[model samples]
Target chain A: MSLSVAMPDRRVRATAAVVVAAVLVVLSVVFACAVGAVHIPPGDVIDGLLDRSDPVTRQIVWQIRFPRALVAALVGANLGIAGVLLQGITRNPLGDPHILGFSAGAGVAAVGLLRVAPEVPLALVPAAAFGGALASAALVYALAWRGGISPVRFALAGVAVAALFTALSTALIATSKLFTQAALAFLAGGLYQRGWEHVHQVWPYTLVGGLIALIVADSLNVLALGDDVARGLGMRVERTRALLAALAAVLTGAAVAVVGLVAFVGLVVPHIARLLVGSDQRVVLPLSALLGALLLVLSDSIARVVVAPGEIPVGIITAIVGAPVLLILIRTRT
Target chain B: MRSSARRTTAILGTAVAAFALLLTACGTDETAVPTATASAQGTATAAATQAAPVGVTVTDLMGRKVTVAKTPTKIVTTSPSALEMLYAAGGTAIARSSTAAAPGIDTSKMTDIGSAYQPNFEAILKLQPDLVVADASAQAPLAGQFEAQLKGVPVVFVGAVKYADVATSIRMLGLVTGTAEKAKTSADAIDATAKQVGDAVKGKTATKTLVVVAGRDGQLSAALNDSFIGDMVKIAGAQNIAAELKQSGQVPGYATISLETAFKDNPDVLLVIVPGNTPGPSISSIVARTFPNLNAVKNKRVHEISLDIFLQAPGPRAADGLKELTTFIQPDVKLGAAVVPGY
Candidate 1:
């Protein structure tokens, strides 16, 4: 529907939204770095950033908060871009990374590895999750395939696969007495205790996934026009959709690997981006990334300070904050 | 239809009158013996002195008055901690929750009654336990269900997350099981060890400490001052860095805090509780990488503690846990044998 807007007007609106979102992302990162379980003054935060503050403040800012906030920003970007790509590929408004059961698949494998073969280094957990996510994605693709993918059939298959994966994840967590508490923390999805190691783990995936989504943005837009029209336009419709789905799976897997299954950010951020700018995939993708980063950083900061000392999972905060914003945007836009 | 309605009304009136008569009789009995109901805090401990062979009335952790009629020979404990306390009180369960395993307690022949959070009530009933011990926090909800289905069986909820409560739970179990003397002995051992550890570290500079409990899935959570391990640290003359962090009630006495807060606190010692049979890089290793200059890392004070004694089964062995904590907190001081109890 937003595609009917004049191209020039849409461009201006997208540019504005992108600029605002980017600014908010930067501000939210700074805010996240400043506030935490411990109180550090704004000047101290700046001084800590420059390595001029006291030892404790310096450690809190540099070692703890800075790495955590960066991880949150990168994860938000990954989930946001993944949401945009999946929604584009499926041509379904409800499409997001979780719609394809990526998070649940990743959760099952990651949790299983952690419980069953805990001797494996913590660093390999993301790989395990990524593998699980891709496996489930393959299954969804196979089930959805009837010579070519129809959007509704694909979505239905995805839902069925997601339910099956979720049940498997629950069973794994339930049967293993050892894994219950920590596995639950992972399943609830949070950036709790994330550090420089997590930042190092996720950034490469975000870069690769974001680039892929951008390179194929034009194809996404053409595909959005309907498959028959896309084929007539000389596009390889099935190949493009498959590539986009695979790309989204990678992005979603990366995000889930670090923070478990954070809900709402991937589901709602793309819609917000489209409502703000227009239905342009090129604009919606980057803007959604920016908005996703902004929303998560802010939500993470709230997660830190609201209960002060005890942290709420970042995923919980995202759902509480994202659902309302998406609803308001939808109401005002309609 | 009118005659049937009249007969139903007559029956309902008879039942109401009988219920009122029963209530008056109970009220009169209570009024005649005002001292029959025990005091709130020391109800169980006080009841232990009474040599009532037929029955004993006491208050449980949930504040419900429970009457254990006849010595409870058959018992079921729904949590590991509850099972430990029961054993410390010189009582044993015919069946135990699957997760209930503790030091010095044998469960090889006991029937597995499933998880404490949702036990198999039918299996428990099949065992026909005279007493059912449940955890106050985790198994509190099952109390109503147990009462409804167990007929005359006494379901006692006893969850001890702190050092003081550990002894209280043991004594409560002892009084109910008619093993009060053995229970008092174990309870006294806990108090003696606490004092021993406290006195040994009294003059030393209080070590700043942080306790990180690694979950089976490798998630790290801080043990607050109110947690069983956290309370032990305090008693061992150390300042818990995460003590001030408010518990959000996800897990009683534990909180998930950002590693940043931990970094800022910069404790002198780090104690990581690792569950038994877990194999991997200790949480201390992860902490080491994140903050290499942490005092605990720099000074070589990061220690891995056993999850079984400190957390999973916080019972008679808590005294041993305290002694272990002191070795890390103030390694120089050695307590005399007075604190050690023969269990």
Candidate 2:
């Protein structure tokens, strides 16, 4: 699985990985639109996509499956980028948004609002989640700051914050019991019953976070070469790290707000991308985006049809599919 | 996203308030549902002169044939609905689940046996003497172990998920407790209520309805034609819009339906469950955001009903639930008295 490449050959390989992943994402979305509790023929799927299908098929494909698939892909891509940024800034191979308790923070706020004051309009949920995620990131940074932030200490603080927030989220669910199903669905992470509204909600974060990730890639690349060397290279080490962590938090928050806490995409997709395209942030970031979209879209498709009518959470599918694939890639790479 | 997202055991544990009422044509027969049948072996008058006490053989909800070899004086009920049936049948349990509450029964004196899903087995055994009545879906899995732990005490599983199951459960408990006459009176009340509701709404065109059990964050699961609430909706002359949907996984009678299906079905009346203490999103607001064109939104027929009356246990208050449904389904039809329970 390890492709030993010459310096010039690495660029071609990374481009190929990105293209292949992009193609897989499109194919998975099309496949997803074609199959569901109600079976739509390939012709009908295409017609539905083009807004020329019969009323029923159009409703199922355009209104239900299409938007849901897009939401899953967007969430996946955002989380994957977040993972790369977090891992890069922390210099920890195991870093992801969840490791920093970003999802937990967001989950607590969103679940609490839904449980306690369910009358709150649906539009406000994403904003609350975003606020909670940023607040938790700030808390972790403050705890880690003795003189300045240390990567190990920052990561440790994130885990503690995440545990605390996760407990609070659970407490809300157990105590309220009214929205247990809704809270559980969100916590478990899925694109169930999602429509264009969720797609509209998530895409802005993807666009902004992605642009920021691209802009900060070189700084991340510099920071990877040890903190002292990065400083010697005229990179503002602490500021860059904080900026990247905040970017990761925004991305994680957006994804959680829309689809809840989908696991593995943030944690595993970046690793898979690094294995395929090497550690250069510029290459890893885009490659991770494509790979993440492919992974989530494919997993969500499987989630929709595996049990049919009734769906398992997309998170479960991601973990079941992601862990084995990552293991095989790691085993072969070594 | 609703019931299907949950593991079978988790759904059964939490949503055990109702199970499949009757195997509907759409697809409830998928689960191995054992119908409850109580056979009183020998006439009540003949047992008066007999030397031995009269025993009754009853097929419980789990398909287990339990023989009550004498009237159970020290009975323990695990679920709230089971306790309701037991109490209605004139049987007083020595211990009851913490959630068990009947209309007039003062459960303050009874020993609490924890939740219906996870009863304190040790506590139950400490107070138990003769028999244990448990919910079929939630606690039936523990029956073999429980009976073994109790050393020959029979555990009769009763799940009143459907409207009719309430009567069946009461009758079974009546026979077990030697209070068949009292059980008949209570059980007949439910039938009379259903008949009255049906007769009131008979001439009117059936209203198309969508009964949703709201999960947090606007996630909704619909009650199909086979659910306890679904039975009431049918009796009240409303055609359940989710009837065509099949049961998903182990969530016996309810199915997770997509919003598109809901929008397409275009139910005339949309009933949302508002669980206690949480004044969930107004149906008008929800409709405006999601499905403005829906008839329910246009007609202002989207109502938020009590979860206890509509979604929870189908116990002694089942008749009350029927009367409540009739008011919603056919507004012109008036009952003699208000049916809302105080609790």
Top candidate when judged by DockQ against the true structure: 2
Report, for every candidate in turn, its global Cα lDDT versus the true structure.
Answer: 0.76, 0.74
Model 2 lDDT per residue over B49-117, tens place: 255656677898778887777778898988887887787777888878776776687888887767664
- For candidate 1, lDDT tens digit of each residue in B158-239? 8667788888888888999999999999888887788778777887888899998776666567888988899889988899
Model 2 stretches astray by more than 4 angstroms = A1-5, A177-179, B1-317, B320-343
Tell how far residue B194 is off in model 2, in angstroms. 9.5
iRMS per model in Å: 28.5, 23.6
Task: Show model 1 residue runs off by greater than 4 Å.
Answer: A1-5, A118-120, B1-343
Q: What is the DockQ of candidate 1?
A: 0.01
Output the lDDT of residue A311, model 1: 63
Q: Which residue pairs of candidate 2 clash?
A: none
